[model samples]
Target chain A: MKIILKNICKSYNGRKVIDNLSYEFTPDKPVVIEGGSGIGKTTLLRIIMGLEKPDSGEVVFEGVSHEAVRFAPVFQNTRLIDKLDAPANVRLAAREISGDAVRAALIALIPKEELGKKVRDLSGGTQRRVEIVRAVLAPSDVIIMDEPLTGLDEGNARRAVAYIKENMEGRILITSSHSDLFEAFCETLLLK
Target chain B: MQTLSLSAALCRVTTSITWADSLKNGTARKILIIVFWLLLWQGASALVHNSILLAGPYESLLALCSLAVTSKFWLSILFTFLKITLGFVLGLITGILCACLSYRFKLFREFITPPISVIKSIPVASFVIIVIIWAGASSLATVISALVVFPMIYHNMLSGLEATGSSLIEMGRLFRFRFIDKARYIYFPQVLSHLHSAVLISSGMAFKSGIAAEVIGRPLQSIGNGLYLSKISLATADLFAWTFCAVILAYLFEKAVSLILKRLSAA
Candidate 1:
């Protein structure tokens, strides 16, 4: 389903954060919202995720959208439940996806043996990989990732970009510093 | 490479020596510390020349060893343990329930705040006497202990729930997660950290306060009554032995609770 944000404007404490921003997320291409720090990248993502309502404008999603839509965030901090293992962490959504599916998805991204290890036990790169696997495996229509590759070496970054590029089948709205994320076959929605 | 290997091996051995595994480990160190303390206690007892004033460890152990064979002793210990443990369990459940209610409804939390504060500030002796007159001495220890434990746990859980990560909640909202998922992932983990510490303190407080209640209540064949008898008869050795039992029980309960917590976290 396509999501349309028309002239969305939001201000916190009388200072405009996301000012008259209009964007659309279709299945054809990934949308990247490129801006400096505190430039409302997160605020804009929060609005799309139904976390915050825009001061003006409306966010319309395709087909049977709830009055208040739910979302999953690919936050910079990973926002992992440290006590739970990777498989447990991935299936922490509403539907309770099959354990086998969770295990399989985690195995596909990282090693299966590490699936039982708590998120806190995993190294930084491994944790990020687990988070990526979690985001990819979740059954969400729109995945809103904010600076998904903030902490990674070149090799892991390439691997993460490759995993996202290869596995992300539906509409994805991501904010990134690496321009190479857009060097792909799919169309790009550049949100200024 | 050869010199580096030797240095690396030395570093490994040195780094492996953690304080937890070193300071209190092995019979040599433990025995040495025990002997030093025992000698000091014995010297003090000898100088006092009064068994009622201070009894040596050996004398206390002798009293404890003799007490262990009696059926009444076993029954008293069992009842005492059961009462305190029940109070601890009740406090834990009540605290969690109250915290959940308070978090959900501001009105409920406001209503509960005064009671919790009143309970916290009330003198232990005052409660013990009040509980004794109200409920009698038979189960006074447990009730008092539970009262002390409830506030710490209830406050900790409420704060813990309030401190849940906004990002995770936002994530849950984004994905349209059910209430159960939001609680299990976002709330439960956040609360468990503080809850674990609160439980330990609560358990200890419950044990101590409950025993104090028993001492005041003077219930039949109870550890509390035994303690009272020790004071009346000036049996300092028996007093120390019973005090040792109480301390050991508290320590063991903490260990058992911590172990269960560890296993739960691992799962």
Candidate 2:
């Protein structure tokens, strides 16, 4: 699968955040976009995910409809339903992913006891890990993660990155992060 | 007054100061407060010396006991209970549906605004009178209860739906969640908190307006009918008894509904 961005321009308050940005993203090579703060890394990811339409130009996908490529996002915030427990939160994405699969993905990172508890009750790092597990286990063609390793320690961050790399093999992975740990696992695309 | 310990302060903020707790601690402060109020009432009743004008608490209690023994009294309770509860449940369902519609569609919300505003501002008596004229006394309580409850639930439910975070909604979109899944996982959980509060406030209003409508319309076999009869016959004790029963019933119903909602939210 290939997604091409053509002269995409986006502005907030008359300041151009994305200035005629163009890129070709293929599923074979995972891309890690590295940039400083306010360089529109998140915004560019949003544009790619088809969440924010650019002020000008468009995105074209070859060999797939936009809907056909199921995109699972690990939002900057762990957007897990606070009302649902960890296992339930993962199961919400698709029926194809079983409770056992979700539990297995989370078991190394999260304690078995915490897996049954609501996401709100989990610590910040645990919640982030839960979000990572949710995105990884979901049946999807593309994975877009916005600072998915924000709350984890180095060891845990490495573990989470390793887990994602192992689980999401041969899929289009797009992530925006400053972490050398995350970039080490995927092909890096620096954004200035 | 000593300064409270940290745990004591936490407990005070988290839980109500119940009479049972006070009694367990041998304080008896709450019991004393109640006794003081009863004495005040007794004194006032004696000073008035006219039972027709002011029945004492003792008289009210005696009247309550007598009414409790009668099958007609129980039937009157049941009759009003069914009508008011049915109306409230119907209002709750309609209010949720209308809130969803209004939240989803701008035009429908604008169209319903004037009616909701008018209903909110109109007096219960005016509605009761109109309902009686239009639908007759038989269903007065039902219509009146629903009318009083509609605006409250609609307003609260709309606010609840509005309170749902846009970020969570975006997440739902990304995940390709079905409408039911979005509602169940994202919307319902947030809205249930608001609905719990709406239930607490509106349940009391439903009972009050439903009974007021019954009194005006004189629905046969209702608690309102008994109160109306008491007023005409100058049966002060019976009037006090009926009023007390209304208060108790309203309190109990609110408690039951709140309990159910709390348990549901917990699960």
Candidate 3:
């Protein structure tokens, strides 16, 4: 899909956080948005995810723009409700995914031992993976992940990176702290 | 001078403390306390030397026993119990309705404040008299009880509603939860403990005010009416018995409500 994020200016209080910036993210391959903290990398991700509306400018996905495109976001923090268990937390968006499908998806990403435990009980790495699986399993046109590799040790991060590479269909846009990951797997779009 | 021995001190004491002696078996301790109080009453009645002034514990117990055998006693208890319970239920409904309506409309809350303040500050006896004059003796007690209870219920329910978390509500909105689903998941869970406390408090108030109404209104076949007659006839034993019965009924209602709350919390 062709995606364009044009003149995306955002500000908090009186200061400019995202200045008049323009970029395009499309799929012949995966794209990474790499930038420093307080450099509007997260703000840019939020604008693309439609979680925030810009002070000025537009985000267009497949030429339809923010008002048109169907979107899903895997947030930086694993925002699982404390009350629901691991499988139930993931199933909130994709209820149609059967027990076996949930089981299989969870088993593929999360260790089998942590499958039955609640998201709150699971370690940070496992919760991160569950959130990624939840995003992957959800039915969405564009999957946007903000800081998706956070908290995972290198081995699990690699496993998750591989899973996303294999399973993504339409488009993958990720915001990250490092560009080396972008170099190895996808084209890098540096935001300074 | 040498200090008195334990037995001499015990013998010289004017009063006994039974509650401290109450070990794990609370019921037995209560019985012991009752017996102690009964002996005290017996001793006091003997010292006074006037049956008109004070009836001993046995006299009250005998009165209660005799009253138990009579149909009027049962009828009085049942009628008073039903009227008070009904008043409680009505007050609960009114409180919840007022709370919800007040929350829904700011103007209504402002309008209600003056009257609630007036009711809360004024004496129950004043309300009882006013209601008796307006509604007559028979219906007055129930009305008084309900009025006495409304503020307690309404304020608690309002606080409960206010305590509902904004974040959880936002989550519910994002999830597109229906009104029923929102209430079940978000509204009820937050407000339940509050409502539970309100119910317990209001239930006790209902009994007290209901009986007080009966006393003032003189409703036939009610515990309050029995109390009134006993006072008129100088039957101190009967008065004590009926008052004991009222206390027991109130205790039982509180216990029953507490049990229900426990079950609800468990669920």
Candidate 4:
């Protein structure tokens, strides 16, 4: 499947965040958007995910209707339910995945004891990892992550990257981060 | 100070402190507080020296016992309980549905504002009189109770829905969550938190307004009628007894609702 953005323009409070941007996303190559903070890396990802409407542009998808394309996203805020445990939060989107499967997937990045604790109680790095597991386990044609490695230590960040690569299953992956941690695995898209 | 070994003195002080802490936090402390209030009430009743003016706790308990043995008293309790509960459940359901619709559609929310404002502004007594004229005395309590509950639940649920984090909703959208999944994960907890307080407050208000409606309408076999009869006959003890029963019923219902909501939240 191919996703293309043509001359997308978005402004907030009379200031342009994304201006005259165009890119084509292919399933074969994962793309990592890199830019300075508040450089509209998130706005670009949100626009592609249909979370925000572009001021002037159209997104064209080939081999998939926009309505039919499902997405799994790791929001910048790790939007896991604060009151739910790790596996339970993962099951929110991945309902078809069994509880055992969720637990097994989470156990790879999360400690066994910590898996039962609510996401709010876990450390920031653990919560980010939980978001990654949730995104990977959810049934989707595309994965959009906004700074997926925000709170991770270097060691856990590597593990998360490795985990995402192993489980992405040839789906189009688009992520935004200020750092180049994903440089080796993903094609870089610099947002000026 | 008496000379003593450090260990012995420390042990004694620790024991005293533990005892004080238990007294402050344990069920025994609650019982003691209640007993203190009961004694104060009894003292005030004695000072009045007239049962008609002020019924003591003993007189109220005695009146309650005498009423309990009679079939009419039980029937009145059942009648009022069923009517108020039905009204409350009706209000609860409609309030939740309306709140959901209002949250989904801004036009509906605006359209509903006037009626909700009227309900909140108008006195319960006025509503009771109007409802009696419209629907007659037979269903007055039910109608009044429902009106009392609806706006409260509606406003609280609406606020809860509004307070839900937008980011979580966006996440749900990206995940392509089904409607049921969105309700379960994204909305349920937020609404439930607000619902807990709303139900508690509204249920109590429903009982109070419902009984007041019955008193005003003089329904044939309701707690309100019983209360009215007790007042006119100058049987202060019976009035106190009926009021006691109403308070207990309201408390029990609130407890049951709170328990159910708590369980739902846990799930």
- For every model in order, the TM-score on chain A comes to 0.83, 0.95, 0.90, 0.97
Best by TM-score: 2
lDDT (tens digit, per residue) of candidate 3 on B1-267: 135576667765623444444434666677878889878989999998776799888889999999999999999998888777777778878988999889779999999989989989999888888887887877765777788778998898888888987655543543344576566656666677788877888888889888987888798899999999999999999999999999999889889978987887655
Q: Write the per-residue lDDT of candidate 3 for residues A8-43, one digit (tens) a residue.
A: 899899889888888777655577777787777777
Candidate 3: pairs in clash: none
User: Over the stretch B134-217, how does candidate 2's per-residue lDDT look in tens digits?
Assistant: 999989888898888888899889999999999999989888888999988889888998998888888999999899888899
TM-score per candidate, chains pooled = 0.80, 0.91, 0.71, 0.89
Name the candidate, 2 or 3, with the larger DockQ value.
2
Query: Model 2: per-residue lDDT, tens digit, A35-142?
Result: 889889899888888888999989888789977878889987668888788888888886587778778878978888998788888899999998888888777888
Where does model 2 exceed 4 Å of error?
A111-113, A182-185, B1-27
Scoring model 2 with DockQ, what do you get? 0.67
The alpha-carbon deviation from the true structure for residue A179 of candidate 2, after best TM-score superposition, in angstroms, is 2.1
How would you class the docking of model 2?
medium
lDDT of 3 at A113: 85
Candidate 2 B-chain TM-score: 0.88
Task: List, residue by residue over B41-152, the lDDT tens digit for candidate 1.
Answer: 9899888888999998888999999888899888988899898998888888899999999999999999999999999999999998888788888878778878988999
Q: Compared to the true structure, candidate 4 yields what TM-score? A: 0.89
Query: Ranking by lDDT, best first?
Result: 4, 2, 1, 3
Ranking by DockQ: 4, 2, 1, 3
